[model samples]
Target: MKAFVLDRYGKGRSLRSADVPTPELRDDEVLVQVHAAGVNLLDSKIRDGEFKLILPHRLPIVLGHDVAGEVVKVGSRVRQFKLGDQVYARPDDLRIGTFAEFVSVKEASLAHKPKALTMEEAASIPLVALTAWQALVEKANLKKGQKVFIQAGSGGVGTFAIQLAKHLGATVATTTSTANVSLVKSLGADVVIDYKTQDFEDVLRDYDVVLNSQDTKTLEKSLRVLKRGGKLISISGPPDPEFGKEIGAPGFVKLVLRLLSSGIRRKAKSRGVTFSFLFMKANGRQLREITPLFDAGVIRPVVDRVFPFESTNDALAYVEKGRAKGKVVIKVR
Candidate 1:
């Protein structure tokens, strides 16, 4: 199998192409022939050693996360899917390797691809869509008629989140550059602020939820836009103690998280708002639930570009630019 292997973690380092043996499938896993893979900022962050404490991935690892492919073989305990089944998934953290020609994915974290989408489109959904699902649906429990502000509305997660929030009947507001206002509005954002021209904190207020995916300054401003008792969920984060406990970090790591998030927690408490960090996990069940929306055209993927498999590093570079309108994909077949 051909793979782009990361030999070491560092800033601005590229993955090396290499021939590696196919992953051995487990009792609850399936071997997928990768057709397309989604590139995410998380991949870059991991490659740069930013998530060492929380994730602790082994060295010389394969880094792709979201995959859309066909099942070539299924493990003994994998009853939900069979040979040739079209699937998409954000594979479990320890098992991710979709940058390769074939990768093994746990059955519990794999979902059938929506028939309405192509492999590249399907590949783009799992990571960003699941992030939106986990943040808005699972954590916030966002309901109809409420107002929510989602930051970086033109980015991968933001584009998906705007559509999901609208589907849930929430009044969605988002911040993006002036050029992307119409794009976010097309995705059902009711209030699209041009961040380059205006401050979101000054314009948006009394929101039920805020999805923060920016720097500490942006996160702080997002907190002010939420009404009392509202939820402020950050994906780009200073991981909080609750998240530290969720990941079951060592005592030292927990203390680090506590110190990193202490100021925001205190400020949120004083304002009667709740603050927490969200790191999305792979969930086939949630992906299955989201499939119907895609099939029905209620939610659609926004793919900015599809790079050839050989240009996987270029795709990562494009996403790292922080200007992609939506998800970037690598056609890996």
Candidate 2:
């Protein structure tokens, strides 16, 4: 099967096209014949060796997180799905390799694709949507009539978080540039700040939760907007000690993470708020719940671009530019 392979970790290095053996299926896994794959900043960060500590991969690997395709084969232990099932997933961190003709995904991490969506659209949903669900619903336990500020409201996670927050009955405030103000508002953002002109800290205050997906500087600024006991979840991090424990980091890596996040953790403590990092994982059950919302028209997929499989590198490059209004996808079939 043809797939893009990363030979070494480096910034600005393009994936090399090659014919590699199809992923070996496990008893609890399904082999998906990839029709489409999603491009994420996570892909780029892994390529640049940014996540070496927490998500170390074997050398000469395939890198992709989001996948939508048909199940060509399923393992004996797979009960809910079979051959010819249309499915989508953000495969487990160690199992990801959807930028290929075929990638094997664990049955627990896979869910049926929404019938209303195209493969490209389905491909765009898993990683970013899961991030939003995990951060707001699972971590923050956001409630109705509460206020939440979601930074970078037009980016991959932002577009989805805004809608999900609104669905959960929270007042949603988001930050984006002038070109994307209307887009975020249309996604049900109650307040939209033009980051190019207005500072979000000045305009947002006393929020119940904040979904931070920006740099260290922006992450720090988000603290002031939250009310006492508010939840501050950073997807882009200075990762905290809790996250290190979750991923079960090495002793040295744990120490490094503790030191790196000490300043922000102390700041959050002083402000009477809690800080945590979110690195979303795959969950078939969560995707099953989310599919109904899309089917019911409560949440919609926001796809900004679709590139051919041959242009997978271009797709990754496009996402790295930080200009996409939503998700970027690579059509593999």
Candidate 3:
């Protein structure tokens, strides 16, 4: 199997092409022959060792999570899929190696790819789509007629969040550069603010929820845009502890998150709003629900670019540019 291996975390230079053995299938796993992979900002953060405290990986790791591929073999205990099934997942960690020709993933994480999309399009959905789904529907419990603002609306998570919010009958507002205002609007955002020229906080008010994917300052301001008793869900760092516990973070990490968000939580409480941090978990169940939306044309992927399998590193670099209109994908077949 061919893979891009990273022995040590540092700059993008660590990514290198090499031949590696195909991963052995676990009794509860499936061996997927990679067809396409999605490159995400989380991949960049992992490569730079930003997540070392929470997710420590073994050395000489393969760094990709969002994958779309055909199942060549299934584990003895796996029942959901079989050989030749087309599946997709954002494997829980970097070691699964979606960058390779083949990778093994737990059955709980793999979902049947939506029939309406190609492998490249299917690959782009798992991580970002799941993040949006969990934050809006699961955590925020968004309901019809509620108003929600999704920051960075043209980015991967934001694009999906806007679409899903609209599908749930929420009035969605989003922030993006002037260039992406039309794109976000097309994705069902009722209001699109040119982030470069206008401050979202100044123009919007009384939201049911705010999906924060930007820096600490932006996350702080998001609270002001929500109504009393409204929720602010942040996917970016400065994590919240109770939220960490909800996602099953372990002892030490849970304590660290509490300390990280103590001040922010207090501030939010003073304003009569709630704050939660989201780190999306891999779930085949949620993916199953999302597939019908894709199949029905209610939600569609927005692909910014595609790179050949051998150029996987280039795809990662492209995503790092912070200007992609949507997700970047690696065509691994």
Please give the clash total of every predicted structure, in order.
0, 0, 0
Better of 2 and 3 by lDDT: 2
Clashing pairs in 3: none
- For candidate 3, lDDT tens digit of each residue in 1-333? 899988888966658899988998889999999999999988888889888877768878888879999999998999999899999998866445898999999999889999999999999999999999999989999999999999999999988989999999999999999888889999999999998899998999999899999998998889889899999888996887776666577898889889999988998999999888888888889999999999999999999999998888888888998999889999989
Show where candidate 3 strays beyond 4 Å. 243-252
**32-146 in candidate 2: lDDT tens per residue?**
9999999999999999999888988998999999999999998989999988999999999988899999999999899999998999999999999999999999999999999
- Evaluated at residue 147, the lDDT of candidate 3 is 97
* Model 2 CA deviation exceeding 4 Å by range: none
Worst 10 residues of 2 by lDDT: 51-60
Candidate 3 to truth, TM: 0.97
- How much lDDT does candidate 2 score? 0.94
Tell me each candidate's TM-score: 0.99, 0.99, 0.97
**Residue-wise C-alpha lDDT for candidate 1, range 64-117, written one tens digit per residue:** 999999999999999999999999999998788999999999999999999999
